[model samples]
Target: MTPHEIGTTFYAYTAASSSVAHILDASKPATFSMVNAHKRLAILIHGFTSSHEDSHLQSIKTNMLHHSNGEVGTVIVVDWRHGASALALPPYLRAASNTQVVGHQVAHLVEELRKHHGVNPHNVYIVGHSLGAQSAGFAGRYALSTFHWKLGRITALDAAAPSFENHPGTFLTKNDAVFVDAIHTSASKDHNPLNGVFGFVHAFAHLDFYPNDGHNQPKCHNPLEIACHHEAALLYYDASLSAHNSCKFYGFSCHDWATFHAHHCTKHDAEMGYFADKIHASGVRFLATTEKYPFCH
Candidate 1:
């Protein structure tokens, strides 16, 4: 879809079974008033060729709601599938172009929420995967530039690498939000042509968590693992929000994977996933995980 033809839709999901409301226009006051933000609000964005109804998004939504313990006021799913649809232009190019448009729309929505609904910007969190992750950064950047509003946090799940790697300021960065955390999975070292490419290898966020060296997730060696490792980042985040918060994906501060593997790094400060705390220190963090389900210990 072309930039002019982009259609950005918002769906609000709350505890009420009938709370699924479609926001036709984000710029209007009516749309903001419709949202019931009694607690924190989470805006979930999907990647290219994905939608609000995708299984991965649904799973993340379910986990967020289930673990919030009624503290989550609402979950807004940003559906920009039209803009992300495959077109004659390269898929990555299409996504890159759409990011600005969709980001503006999302920023407007947040502005409206703060202005009309009295929703605090600090109570808003954005979680996006793959190309959507880059779009989230754009949204945060727009919010700060246009409204001077800093988002609470932004969690990037294996942000897309192609067309974004080395393109500083084009994709997600620590400056996008007050606290930006990135989970790097399926990242290709040196742009390895043999490995399946999905996520960026460079550390872009304040807290960059690398699980299993950030590549070739166990049990995902086959061709069907298109987004297997990338998607695992979401699952890992979900696990962090498990009931009672039993799982903790502890991360150790490290300058590089080589030093981390060599046991040279000793400071373990950052915790990967939902319950992650905001730390002043910034650097690459390494953490190990199990190959089976309940990967986090």
Candidate 2:
């Protein structure tokens, strides 16, 4: 659909939803523990085959709030029903309907939030990890086309670079997201063509390549890890926190990690601990009240 058309739909959706007194109540903080009353809204998109608890999502949410002062704003963690078999999908079909559907769902959700709580579209930002990055890209594009949604930023952390490679320019309009930024990690051992293609895009505002060899860092092969950070997702996010605040874009990889070996989750936890602390210091703005992890002070 044309971008203008999409924007109209988004506006109508938000307005209709707002008229319901219970809509805001339905979106209560209990719905998303970290969400607060006054702060702006930030949506968290999980990587492919991953959940909100994934390290990358956790790290980004932690970091953004860290930089914003314990008040990181509202985080809406998106979860899709795509089966775990996405790993097995012939690369071609993976980007087809799945990408469009998820993007639409997120857009719809944003409208609901905007109308219900008077959230400013310009203040809304989406931080996506892995496949979630692709979701952020599509959502941003949809919003841009509709014109009703203007964002502070859409940060794609090592976004799913492969699935969108061959799609027509319709998916990516020129300068579509002026405020959009991306970060990619070269340290990842995954050799997928899509990943390579995704890395080539000039859309990335900032790119950080990690060392190819490091102690304790594992290869980017585990499906769960690949699903989350096969190329060490959280670690990549940790390295990209210091840049300016315009719709962050970051990528990461570790040194000497193979695309076959396995690593433990604690290894990820350690990385997150450091990132969480750094975000708290970076001045990213967040909503008060502890949810998953206390906003590092």
Candidate 3:
């Protein structure tokens, strides 16, 4: 078996003190030589209060290192300059309130990647979760309009519906990527219909919904449930493996938290780790197929 190779690139940014809006970041082009050369390039943005190595992106990076056929690729982790110094949850909430700034940072990074590495626009992919997802969408929009940088695909994993819905350009209708797919965890009971995200739901080239509330993903400490949702996302993403089909939606069910909490299911951090990995694997499969590969080569 080939050993997996992985590397990280950091981006620096300056934003208004009041909001984390990206002002300027120009050093991204210098970091491409540090990336692994065996897989498709992946740009992973961490959510607010999270590190560049957050579990969401790290797990996927691990998977790609091992699974990518002899061609390793770059994984750029965009660290919010002040994000590391702030409290995790609270700042995430505050920062998420305005995601366009982060998106601007992503747009800058993408341009640098193109100019420095000469990466084909169609070979790059963006992956994000929650606020990060919103950032990915924002970046995709900016890239399209400014550079006409078409992407192979963009995947938003269980993104918070706030920026996704309320913002016009975040969804496909506003500035659709060459390919866009979203997986919103059904774990939230408060999916306000009045919110723009609900309306934006229909714009994804492909969309997936879990049966549980936004917080109730598999491994709400239940291995069985985790396996199920993992399988569901895997299958849903796999449907596009042939590259001939357009995007679609998959609605899956995991144990609802209301029931889990009501029944007092034993909560284990270990179990949560399991499910997170499963979900990440599902994401990896989706990403692998979206690029130009030997199968499509």
* Best by the lDDT measure: 1
Cα error, candidate 3, residue 22 (Å):
22
By TM-score rank, best first, the candidates go 1, 3, 2
TM-score of 2: 0.56
Better of 1 and 3 by lDDT: 1
Best model per TM-score = 1
What's the distance in Å from true for residue 26, model 1?
A: 1.6
Model 3 bad stretches (over 4 Å): 1-25, 28-30, 36-39, 70-72, 81-93, 170-175, 186-189, 192-203, 207-218, 221-297
Q: Mind giving the per-residue lDDT tens digits that candidate 2 earns over 136-187?
A: 6677677667646655566655555454644655233224343454444432
Question: Which scores better on TM-score, 1 or 2?
Answer: 1
For model 2, what is the C-alpha lDDT against the true structure? Answer: 0.43
Q: What is candidate 1's TM-score against the reference?
A: 0.90
Q: What do the candidate models score in CA lDDT, each in turn?
A: 0.79, 0.43, 0.44
Which lDDT tens digits does candidate 1 get at residues 123-176?
888999988898899999999988999998898999888778887778889898
